[model samples]
Target chain A: MGINTFNIEEQGFLTTKLSEFIRWAQRNSLWPMPLGISCCAIEMMAFAAPKYDVARFGSEFLRFSPRQSDLLIVAGTVTYKMARVVRKIYDQMPDPKWVIAMGVCTSTGGMYRSYAVVQGIDQFLPVDVYVSGCPPRPENLINGLLKIQELIKKGVPPKRDPIFI
Target chain B: MEEKIDKIVESLGRRNIEAEIRQDPLGTEMILNVGPQHPATHGVLRLVLKLDGEYIVDAVPELGYLHRGKEKIAENMTFLEFLPHTDRMDYLAPLSNNTAYMLAVEKLFGIEAPKRAQYIRVILNELSRISSHLVWLGTFAMDVGALTVFMWCFREREKILSIFDIVTGVRFTTSYARIGGVAQDITDEGIHAIKEFIDNFPKELEQCEKLLNKNRIFIERTDGIGMITKEQAIDIGLSGPNLRASGVPRDLRKDEPYLVYNELDFDIPVYEEGDCLARYYVRLDEMKESVKIVRQCIEKLPSGPVKADEPKATLPKKEKVYTKMEELIHDFILTNFGGTPPVGEVYHAVENPKGELGFYIVSDGTGYPWRLKVRSPSFTNIQELKVRGKGNRRDDMVGRRGSIDTVMGEADK
Candidate 1:
């Protein structure tokens, strides 16, 4: 059940599923843990800046602390050394958290197919959305955030089973 | 952990700080790890600070968290292929990095970019300087508790990025500069946007300056904090505005006069007081200088070909390649095998937004460089933290590091 009827002047009550209410709350307020590692981080900052204004989607609060955030926006190249730190941060974030791989470098290692860079972050952490660009534009990042919101609204659980290191 | 502490102590002994550590009344020297992930460190730069109560006893900057084996990759790829990778190094000022790398390759090839290309390069380089400094100013202001300045800086920065979009077709990683010239000519729209940005930029810059330049809290936080003497700055090899802040007038644009810098009239903003505020002021003044330089370049903009007439070193035009058989063959060879420079070595440095970004390439008369060493300014600039961070209050550490402004990608590379 959702909002069935409404009256401005009269005392009225509306009923909705508890899950629906929770999902709506969760979808609207996905506090991001910005893992701004490189070039994409600039674009990520732009997403949060006055121009793109991620605050409109209710995801403006960029929690540097993983424990306080529900969304992990890994916004650059993830090297092998940094992968451990990334995984640790991902583990620290509470349940129902989603990951947005915000650039080509984080997605399939992009052009940096070196020994140092991790081929893809999905090898260690469960990434929900992949925004593809050498460094994705602010609009592209916003589109990725919207997709994450859509996923939350649909109640799709994040795939937590990462490939064992 | 025990060995690490011992090593630190031994290093401190060399620096003559062992007596102070040994004579401490309260054995409360705690180690603080600032990041490989924290926000203020600015892109995976980790600082391991040894703290005595509220004061930092020593600061050791542990780098390489963002090292993508850039030099190693450069060894494998052709000169043209490696240009895009340069964008990721100093991610904030990609155009400067692009121009720096291209200049190095051009030196090896013994060919200069055309006058038009030189002017365009200068314009882009100065624009990137403004953008990079804006990011640094925003993030640095955030480090010192001035949140409003960050938003204001980014608002101005967005205008610059839109201009980048018009010129280079990419906003963030504009790998626009080619070996002999830029990828394309600056359009009429691009010129118009730049002119508009330069005209309106100063007022926006002044608004930001008003917020932080005289605000009591901002002054209290930055003034007399992270003081590095002129000698210390020189000894530590601090470059860019950081060195200039310490009263060293070693600007590459002024001293070396690369591209059309000699043609343009701009001042080097140097400060004798090498504190955090001095660094801030130098950068602020430098941004205005950058605006002036861009305006001059626009006024002195040439109409000739942007690309140099070097068939062996530069790529053929796409239209010409498609139309003519000879040009198509040249394109195929250039794209696949890349330009072959004579067996030699060349080191070229540009006044990047951060500092002197120098590339040393040793070629074996092949399509690729035998050895490529990136003399990234951040790597050298970060060393001052180890020297200057001692005895400062722990809270001031963020401001100190921000004032220096090291990007991890360049540092680690």
Candidate 2:
């Protein structure tokens, strides 16, 4: 059986009829907005290239003007001033959006704990998946995408908004 | 009360929000501010655009958002300690940044990176070029409304980052490239992963080419956009793909021949269109060339110590430092970071992912440089935006901006 099928089988022990199709769709297509910051942004680029082919899952669409995007992949460090802009971008996206906090910088600010960095983007935005690595490999991003699909299927819509405005 | 507050907020130093409605001299066009903070502007650069409604008449780029006094920082930190900070300059290619700065210091001390270290640096630098090109391709696509390409590119990039992690134990801001040689040696797993990645990437390239390389939309959005003559490109001091696309065959790796780049075999892809499409094609072709270089670096990988065997110039081995008292003290000093360099001036330049990243260091015989200057590629590449942004539609400007692949962090730094 395919990995997705096996995953469904393993988790299907107590499956909900309502989430089955949603689970399948979410797993297959997790469109991500590439919120590139720095060098990690380039690695994020590599992940999207032919060798890794993120499109196989159906989320290859990296929407820029966030209105159409459903996923925000933070791929670099969020500096002090840039933090506000990141929040604004996340807010601009439509509902049902997922934030895959790619790389340690966006996950926990990585090794740069300087005064200029915001530590982790999650402090200001609700992160759905935190992909670790000083700068994560394309494999990590792929795995993170799958994990986010799992999270989406879990169907727990947490009500924690990082900003009130 | 809210309306008044909103008006106050809107008027309060809020520059470059929108060009649709802004004040300028009569007969002047709509002024599009490309950035104060933008994706392709490369760092915190701001552009004052004068558009005749939609056709830009003039463009002026305002810079200095990342002016954190880098030269001043160099003055404060020891020579080796300052290497990591240099990594932030052209961040998309930190290894190149690291190498150029390290080479500057090494030149001052008159030492060479070990053969093994040189080989690894060559591999990483070429990989950095490929990574940088992917970002350029993805974002350039996003700017043109081809969002799908971005995700596809990121998927492939993930593998490269993993390879980097295996070698350096860190990614993004890798201080892997250090003075005298690389700080850490590449492990066996790292080499295998890289080999697999290289072998598998060609098909991915084909997929991407199928997706957009010749798509009608991709052609329509980028073709003839951001047009520049070869003479204009040269006059502007444009380097890297921007220059190559304009029919200039200038590559620091070929011209300057630093590191093992001289020993490596690869092709430099060039084009003569001098437009958005040309630039895009150049970078895509460059990615293929970089892959060629990566493979060559792997095939000829030599065996030796990764760092210069010199004491005082290179850090002592970690194993010895742990056991030997004298070595331990040296290690402590290297980590603690505050030793002076012998006074002199040296400039080191590298063919970075963007373009030429040059470091000009003036040392007053101290660890800190008395005066430090970085010749950044993004900053130079961004300069061309002024020339291209003119006479373009509002929507078209973004696409034109994307072709340049400007990284604000490097530009501003």
Off by over 4 Å in 1: A1-11, A162-165, B1-27
Question: DockQ (Cα-based) per candidate?
Answer: 0.85, 0.20
Best by DockQ: 1
Locate the minimum summed-lDDT window of 10 residues in model 1 chain B: B11-20
Candidate 1 collision pairs: none
Q: After superposition, how far is residue B34 of candidate 1 from its true place, in Å?
A: 0.9
For residue B137, give model 2's deviation from the true position in Å: 1.9
lDDT of 2 by residue, B236-292 (tens): 888988899999999989998988877777888889899999998888888888889
Let me know the TM-score candidate 1 reaches against the reference structure: 0.95
**Alpha-carbon shift of residue B11 in model 1 (angstroms):** 16
The 0-to-1 C-alpha lDDT of every candidate, in the order given, reads 0.90, 0.75
Q: What is the lDDT of residue B152 in candidate 1?
A: 93
